[model samples]
Target: MKRFFIGLTIVIILGLFVGTGYFLYQKSEEPPIIYETDTPFKTDIIKKTIATGSIVPRKEVALKSQVSGVVEKLYLEEGAQVKIGDLVAKIKIIPNVVALNNAQAQLQTAKINFDNSEKELKRQKELFDEKVISEFDYNQFLLDFNLRKQEVEAAENNLELIKEGSSQKTGNVSNLVRSTVNGMILDIPVKEGTFIIESNTFNEGTSIASVADMSEMIFEGKVDESEVGKINVGMDLSLSVGAIEGVIFNAKLEFISPKGESDEGAIKFDIKAAVDLKEEYFLRAGYSATADIILQKASDVLAIKESNLIFEGDDIFVEVRTGEQQFERRQVKTGLSDGINIQIAEGLTEEEVIKKL
Candidate 1:
C-alpha cells in the first residue's frame, strides 16, 4: 500500500512538471509579425511644412497718447469696434507750472500793450481829424493798434491751451485722442485716472489701447530655418486654429523674415500670411494656430504610404507583393511627400500591392 501511494505521488509530480514546462515554452514563443500590405492609389501628394503661430491682425496698431496727462476718460473698451479718426480717449492735460506761468505773463504783457495801443490810436485819430498829423503817420499808429489787439487774442488762446489742454479756437479736438485706423479695439491697457506719457522724440509714450483690423487677419508664425528656404511669398497656407475648431482658414504667404530668431537653441524664421476668414466666422486676435505651408504638390499621381518605402544607399525602393506573403524588391522614384503619402513618379502602378515597412 505504501509503495502504491509513493508511485502515484511520483507520477503526479512528473505530470505537473511536464505541463508547466510546456506552458512556459508556449508563452516564450512570440507570434509572427504579420506585415500589412497596401496598394498604390491615385491621390494628391502635397509636400508641406508645419509652422506653429497665432492669428493676428495684419495691421495691429498700438494707440499711444500724444500729450502727457492723466487718462480722464476712455471712450472705447476691449472688443469694441472702432473706425478711423474715432475718439478713443480723452487725456486731461496736466500742464507744467512753469509753462502756465510763462503763458500768464505773456498774456498780461499783450493786454498792457493793447491798452497802450488803444490810447495811442485814439490820440492819433484826434490828431488826424484836427489835420495836425500827416496821413502816413496816423495810418502807422492805426496799424500798430490793430497788431497789438491781435497779439492779445493769441496770448489768451495760448494761455488757455497750456492750462486746460484746450482753447476756444480748437473745437472738440483738444485733449481728445483719436484712433488712427479703422479696426476693432483689442485692448485698453490704461484705465481712467491712469497717468500716461505722450509719444514724443524722447520717449515712445504710454500705449492707451491696441486696435487691429479684424476683418483682415493674418497668420504670424515661425518655422524651422531649414524649411524657410523652400517657402516664398504667395504660397498657399492651410491654417488650423486651436480655439476655433472644425474650420480651416486659408491664407497666402506674404512675408518671410530676412533674419532668423533663436528659440530653444534652434534657429527659426518668422513668417506672415494673410488669412481669408469666412463670413460666418469671427476670429479673435492672438488665437493659437498651426499652419501647413504647401511647398510642393502633385495632382492625381500614383502614390503609396511613405512607410511602405525602403531606403538604401543613394536609392529608394519598395517591396511589391507578388504572391501570398511574398514581396519582391523594386526600385521606385519618388517625388513629393507630405510626410504621409508619397508620390511614386516611376516604377509602380496603381494596381500594385506594396508591403508596409
Candidate 2:
C-alpha cells in the first residue's frame, strides 16, 4: 500500500511540472509593443469660436410721443426719413371743460379791467393836455393803460389755447409733434385720430414717434459668461447679419455689461458692438447677427498636432522617430494651439517625426 501511495505522488508532481513549463513557454511567445510615429511639418492652424445672434443697429433710438389728444393726422409712416423740426404727427386737442371754463373767466375779468383802465387813461390825457394835470401823472396813466391792454391780450391768448391746442399767433388748432432729431421713422404708434396722452410729470403719455439715426447702427447681442471675460473693449469682430444675405460687416466690441443676467438658468453677459458698415447693406434695427471676435492670432508659427503631446510633471513630451523602426521619448515646448495643432516653440524640429501614442 505504501509503495502504491508513493507512486501516485510522483505522477501528480510530474503533471504539475509539465503545466508550469507550458505556462512559461506561452509567456515567452508574446511580441514587444511598437509605438506609431508621425512626421511634424508646416501646417496652418486657426482656432475660432462660433456664436449665434441677430444683427441690430448699433445706435437705435426708441421714439415716444407725449400728448393727450386725438391723433388728427400722421404725415409720415415707417421707413420715412425725417429731419429736425419736421412734422411727424398732428394731435387734435379736445378742450377739457374744466380748463376751458377757467380760461374764459380769466379773460372776462381781464376785459372788464381793460375798459376801466382805458376810461381812466382818456380822462388823464385830457387833463394833461388842458394843463390840469402834470406830465408825470399823465405818463403814469398811460403806463397803466398799456399794462392792462397787454394783460387783456395775454388772457385772450391763454383762453384760445385752452379751447384749442394752438392760438392764432401760434398758427393753428393742430399741435404739430415735430421730430426732435434727424433720423428715419422706425415706427408709428398712433394712427390718424388715435387719441394719445401727452407725457406729463405724473405719467408717461402715448408714444407718437419712434425715430432713430438709421445711418448709425449698433450690434446688440449676448455672450456666454465664460467668453465675456476674455473679450475687451476695442476687440476686432466680423459679423454676419441674417437679414441681408451673404454679407459680412466688420465691428468692434464697445460695451460689456459688468452684471450678468440669468438666462435659462445660465449666466450670460450682454454685449454691444459697433459695426463698421463699409458694405452699406440695409441693416434694419433689431436684425439678428452672429459675431466672430478675433481675440488673438499668430501667423507663420511653429506648430504640431496637439494630440501627439503628452504631459509629465512640469514637462511636456512626445515620442519622435529616432530611426526607421525606433522611437524615443522626446521633451517639447509648446505654444498657442488652435486645438488641432499646437505651436511647437521648442524640443522638436520641423523635420522630426512624433509618435502619436
Tell me the whole-model lDDT of each prediction, alpha carbons only: 0.90, 0.79
lDDT (tens digit, per residue) of candidate 1 on 33-103: 67788899998888889999998888899998777889999987899888889999999999988998999
Residue 102, candidate 2: Cα error in Å is: 0.9
Structural similarity to truth (TM-score) of each candidate = 0.83, 0.75
Give the residue spans of candidate 2 off by over 4 A: 1-54, 62-66, 170-174, 200-203, 223-229, 244-246, 257-270, 320-328, 347-357
Model 2: per-residue Cα lDDT at residue 46: 58
Report the lDDT tens digits of candidate 2 across residue range 1-357: 999999999999999999999999999897867777777767655555545666654445554444467888888889999888888887777778898888888889889999999999999988999999999989998899999998888888888776666677767644678888888988886788788877778877788878888677777777888788788899888898777778889888889899999989878888877778765567777788888877667688777778888888999998878777788888888877787888887888877777875
The Cα RMSD in angstroms, rounded to one decimal, for candidate 2 relative to the true structure is: 7.0
* Clash number for each model: 0, 19
lDDT of candidate 1 at residue 230, scale 0 to 100: 93
- On TM-score, the candidate that comes out on top is 1
